[model samples]
Target: MWKFSIRRILIMIPQIILLSILIFMMAKMMPGDALSGLIDPNIDPATIEERREALGLNDPWHIQYADWVGGAITGDLGQSFRFKMDVTDIVGQRIVNTFWLSLATLIFTYLIAIPLGITSGRYNDSWLDQSITGYTYLGFATPLFIFALVMLWIFGFHFGWFPTSGSVSPGLEPGTVDYVISKIYHLILPALSLALITTVNTVQYLRSEIIDTKQKDFIITARSKGASESRVYNSHILRNSLLPIAAFFGFEITGLIGGTIFVEQIFGYPGMGQLFLESIMIRDYTVVTAVVLLFGIASILGALLSDIILSLVDPRIRIK
Candidate 1:
């Protein structure tokens, strides 16, 4: 297992390097340099050239990429052109916000998906399963942005049950209980928006897996042995059915990070997603490239984690 993990990590090095080269070239292909955001089109040519030189944008693409990669190894992601601040610092702050939002969404996802899926699968062709299927169809059909808007209106604007946007209420003292309550309140709608779709998707996958697993020879053998139906389902069926679900958990987390962008934007939440959108609008190459690289690295790490988890859950996977 350890050897497998080490091998995977070794493989990731080249994948990440190739990813960086692709992203760097894509960023270079974009219409303007970082300084374009800061300088007016009417600015004197010599002035722009000097500014570009000062910022080292005058260097060749390979040189700049090498410098960026070297700095990244030292935990420096470079400064954002738009924010005029360290990329690490800016992204770090947003990561905390995104973490909380994603955490809440994840909790909601599993809490809802597990029971709903199990029940729906166990009761296949029954009214209960039919109802769950119908509900999930709605979740699958609704676009995320549309869902966000409907939620913002129903909960935030109309009912006043939850705050529509932002991480917390303005002027609340940060450490107090009230502040915590307010933060959670603000999070409810956006988190629900993200979690609803994920839950529905998870439920569908789990339901399918459960149905398949329940038909396996082992499940039939357990039934024939006169094990109680509940024990057969719970002790054997659920455990085996959840293996594939467990394997995908890491990838789901990375997907949540990417999904958070749209949710955060709609909710006016200050997270990496919002930062990424703003950075793109401003053509902040350093920030854009950094975020893209972050996403790529995260994806590779997620895949690695998923493989490890699969091996742990089913030792047969480790042998393979």
Candidate 2:
């Protein structure tokens, strides 16, 4: 397993390098560089040039990229031309906010998915099964942002139940309790929006796997032994069915990060997505590169973790 893990790490090297290069090139090629955000209409050209030189923006692309990569390695991450602070520092503050949103979405997806998946699995052609299947399809078809809008219209504009936007109600003080509660409140719309896209996808996959398992020789034998249907499912099917889903846990997390790019806007949630967009608009290449790198690291780490967890749960598929 250790040998396999080392191999995996080695394989990841090129991927990381490729992403680094891609991020560098894209950041550079985007219309207007960092200085575009800083230049004032009334500023003298020489002063602008001097400011550009001061920020090392006058350097050739290769020189700039080399310096950027070096700073990234040392955790310095350079300064955001837009925010005028260390890019890492800016992202660090936002990481907690993003983490909260992502975590809530993850927990909620599973909480609803697991039970519905199990139920759908247990009753193959029953009314309950068909109803769940239809519901899941509805979720799958709806775009997440559109779903968020629908939710906003129903629960926010019409009913006036929850706060429509932002992480919390205005003027609320921040702290551990308030912080957590604020997140929970803000998490609802985006979570549902994102979860809607996934619940059907996940539950349907799980249901199909479960139904397949029901036909297995072992399951039949267990049923012949007069085991209750629920017993057969709990003792035999759920864990095995969950294994495949478990393998994609990391990917799901990464997907949530990607999805946040749009969902964050509809909800006005503070997270990496909003940060990335704002940085891109200002051509804050340093900040853009930092967040993208962080996201890449997160995805690779998630894949690595899913592998480890899957191996632990199912002995048949060793990491080696």
Among the numbered candidates, top lDDT falls to 1
Q: Tens-digit lDDT track for model 1 on 1-320?
A: 88887887888899999999999899889999767777787988999899989988999999988987898889898778678789999989888888899889988899899999999999999999999999899999988888888988998899988877789899999899999998888887899889988788889999999999999999999999999999998899999888888888887887787678899999999988898898898788889888888878878888888888888887777623
| lDDT of candidate 2 over 1-320, digit per residue (tens) | 66666777787788888888888898887787767766684779899889889989889988998988888899898777677788788988888778877887888888888788889988989999999999998887787778878887898789987777777766777776876687687778777767767667778988999999889999989999999977888889887798888887877887887878777777777778888888777667778878998898888878777776666667567664
Native-structure RMSD, model 2: 2.3
What would the TM-score be for candidate 1 when compared with the true structure?
Answer: 0.94
lDDT of each: 0.88, 0.81
- Candidate 2 — which residues are off by over 4 angstroms? 318-320
Q: Which ten residues in a row have the lowest lDDT in candidate 2?
A: 311-320
For model 1, what is the alpha-carbon lDDT of residue 136?
A: 97
**105 in model 2: Cα distance from truth in Å?**
0.6
Candidate 1, superposed: residue stretches over 4 Å from native: 318-320
